[model samples]
Target: MKEYKFLRILDKFEKIYTKIGVDYDKMRLILSMKLTLDSRRTSTIMQDQNKNNNEEDKNIFNRALIIYAIMGIFIGITAMVSFNNMYKFSILFGMFMFLVLTIFISDFSNVLLDIRDKNIIGTKGIDNKTINAAKITHICYYIFLTSLALSWLAIIGSFRQSPLVGIIFILELIVIDVFMIVLTALLYLLVLRVFDGEKVKDIINFAQIALVIIMTISYQFLGRMFDIVDLNIIYKSKIWNLFFPPMWFAAPIYAIEGGHINQIIIALIVLAIIVPIIAIILYIKNTSKFENSLSKLNIAKDNEKEKKRGLFYKIGRNLCFNNEEKAVYDLSTSIIKKEREFKLMTYPSLGFVVIFPLLFILIFSVDSFSEIKNISLHMSLNIYWFIFMVPTILMALQYSKDYKAAWIYQSTFVNDKRNIYKGAYKAVISNLLLPLYLLESIMFIVIFGMKVIPILIIGFIFMLIFIVIQHIISKNKLPFTLKMGEIDKGQNIISTLLGMVILGVAVGVNYFILINTYLLIIYGVILTIITFIMWKKCILDFSTN
Candidate 1:
């Protein structure tokens, strides 16, 4: 009876849902319960950064909407920009689709992967079909709101074309939104097939990391999609390009806006309409299997997976300074990798270090590897993301849900506490970030030629120096020293913002001399010396206090 506003509106669609073979009452009941629980939850992406860690309960959902609306401003600007309407819309739709997809990947994982309904509702004899309907509905409810926040300006901007066009745009968008969610569902289904419970979770986390880099970096290549001839950006419809969904969605706008609808355009529009219907039908048929797959989440760990020693442990054993530090390194790696809460709340720039250059290559230079010589220097921008992200994510090492075990940090008899901090830092570096950074440097050298070697070298040195400095300046607690609930949200936000300013200075200094081989060598030399000095004496002074 305590229906949310949207659920109340959905009640009017009971007949339509019943026609689709959904149990209207049961689905609504499930949704009402789930939403009631989740409405208290903070948005993972926003995380209400200014909230005091110890603050009592409050709804930051409105704050989340504000964040979405700000993000929407960029999408709105993309819509209003003058270009070939088709190309413009393609960019708009591409950004929109990726935005929705990335947000879905980031925030909707819990709903999509939840197994509670299977245990609770299924035992009551409700079928998987109804349970799945509720799950899908739960995801849709929030996605719909987020999309509207993003789409509001785009939608209103369309009315300038005509009310009928505006109305038509709404209809098309509704169809396209349905398409996106199913497309996402199908992607998850594919992931579900290959990985069992924990592995699937890791893939989802990697996806969150990967898609985010892809979204920001892909914009660099958007201009390439349109051919500029005679000082005019003209988009020619290519039959081969129809494989992209944004093109399918944008074709309707192209046809309606002063263009003769040809076979290709008509086909594109038809697919835009028909494909989502087929996808929905297909998804409905798979509803049971997808629900049943939830059992895997509750299943025991994979025996072989448990047997493997991680590459990080091997590397950390040699890379760390001493035995105690090496032990701490391995311990940190285990906690960081295995803790879901850490993965969810944490922002490891190490992921960015590994993901950024690869995503940059995939986006900017995928088509013209040899020709995009200009992008080589521009690739230095990749370092900016990791630098700016380091302070926030690196801080995650200090907090864990199992904070009670942090007493072990004190129990260890050691002359200096710095070893404890140093060990964990070395683990993060050796286990993954360091090797991947070097590997990516080799890939960059191969693709962009030797011209980018100095940039890559400077980036690696800077990554080491920055992480050391940030860790030293951050709280001097032992790893996993505080409960996750006690995260210093406000302090963390301020420090992260401050890190951005410092990182900007680092980037500016790096870029100032990057083109000159002499200054580049000098800068790298000075940076390397500073790195050694910091790693030895200064980094530990404040880090262990």
Candidate 2:
């Protein structure tokens, strides 16, 4: 047999995991080999750079992976310090799981259900059980790598506290991690079986985005909760702990460390045992069905229906651009709504947009009703931070995996490059910025009352001016027309910093100088005129030729 390119990586994993289960490890090795080969092939990293030059690229990638893991260790340390030494084991264990769980849901979910793997591996004589087990264990290998980096600091702290607690902590970490990997795999299988196989790919993409949002909000919300109360209060609250997944693992830690071995501890242990067993049984039993489903997944279903036109088409069209720009508008819209790579780059900003304002409210708002009224005031000012998303969206708009396909823009006759710029500008505003602004606006209005409407309006106009100027600077590049790696990273960082500074000044002026309704209306009109002039100059100034 010809040795596969990925055989070396798989052999490394196989030597360790083989002790766990021979058949599963073998399948995992094969699946890992296939997935690694597929990824390298798609990434075209080694394709562009031959064996002679690729050594540096490989080193760069390994260095990046190590840096990411180091960042995780820092997060674990942060979580540890925040707990102030109370419920040391629970806090440490919870921090590790929290980091891993977020990474699993937000990052690894797609890897788990990569349709390429299903299509390639399923066609072989491999049984569904082996294939399914292979995917789970492959994910485990990744989590294990992450765990090694994430757990070391926490584990050292545990040992420093008590040897028994340290030992139990390691044991609980293994159980919870295995339990998490199995449970997540089962969820992927369930989603695959329930949704159309072709659609499952898209469903997983959106599911990952949704998970990022949930994780961001939960992290901020929990951080606030932890600040207000001691870690012990949270651990002891049966009601709170029931809803918390980390607490489930922490229950044993609590039991081992002098807490009563009561119904809750018993329940946690039973669940710890039962959930993985059930996941394993269900996965094994449905292995054939799962394989059959994957095979049939690509078959088109006649029952699928066309989605109706959305509000973006109706309202955003009129707000941003004219008829000549619709081609650019529609192209940009399709790319954002459909492009997975675009979403992967852009969605992190969306998470921060939503998370930051909520964090501002949490951090600044005092206990008094009057002071609470000021929360919305702070939110209205902070919401202008979303102005930065427009520039980020524009920067992201320039890159694509299929960037070569963008040659059509050059070949086809384009009357004016301005239409393309106008359309893309509106697409970012309408699709990304407008929705975010509206969400923040409504949130501020409900909390601060109707008075916030003026501040939001003023802030919106300045943001309009800000993105318009930023667009003019950046509009030379067409949407999805450049390879992601080809974009000027230094220029992007400078533009992003400038955007933050400009937005900061605008928010300060609005919050302080434009407080009155008359001043706001006058400023809004002046800024609106400036925005219009900037848009006109922006389109005319840039030329694709």
So what's the TM-score on candidate 2? Answer: 0.80
In candidate 1, position 89 carries an lDDT of 76
lDDT tens readout by residue for model 2, 1-545: 23544446666766444443346545856765755543333222111222333232232334334755676677556434534332444456556665676667645555655556557765775555566667666666656656766677777766766788678767777777776666666665676778874466556555555555564444443333333454244433444544445556666656665666667667765665666677766766665566566553465543222311567654656764566578777777767766666776777567677667756676667543367655645456777766667787777777887989987778877777677777877877787787778888887787789877877887788877886768655544777777654655466777777777777777777766644778878888899899888877755435344
Each prediction's TM-score against the native? 0.86, 0.80
**CA lDDT of each candidate?**
0.72, 0.63
Candidate 1 lDDT by residue in tens digits, 1-545 = 35588898999989977887789998988888776666555455554443442332454555777778888887888666656777777787778877787677657767787788799789998998899888888888878888888888888777776686678777776766677778777766767767786677667667666655665555455556678899888876667556667777788888888765778788888888888999999888888888887676665464434522766566666767677777787688777667766776553245556666566666755566566655556665564564455676677777787889876766778777777878888866765566666777776676667788888888878888888867755654677876554556667767677667778898888777777999989999999999988888875634332
Per-residue error at 414 for model 2, in Å?
Answer: 1.7
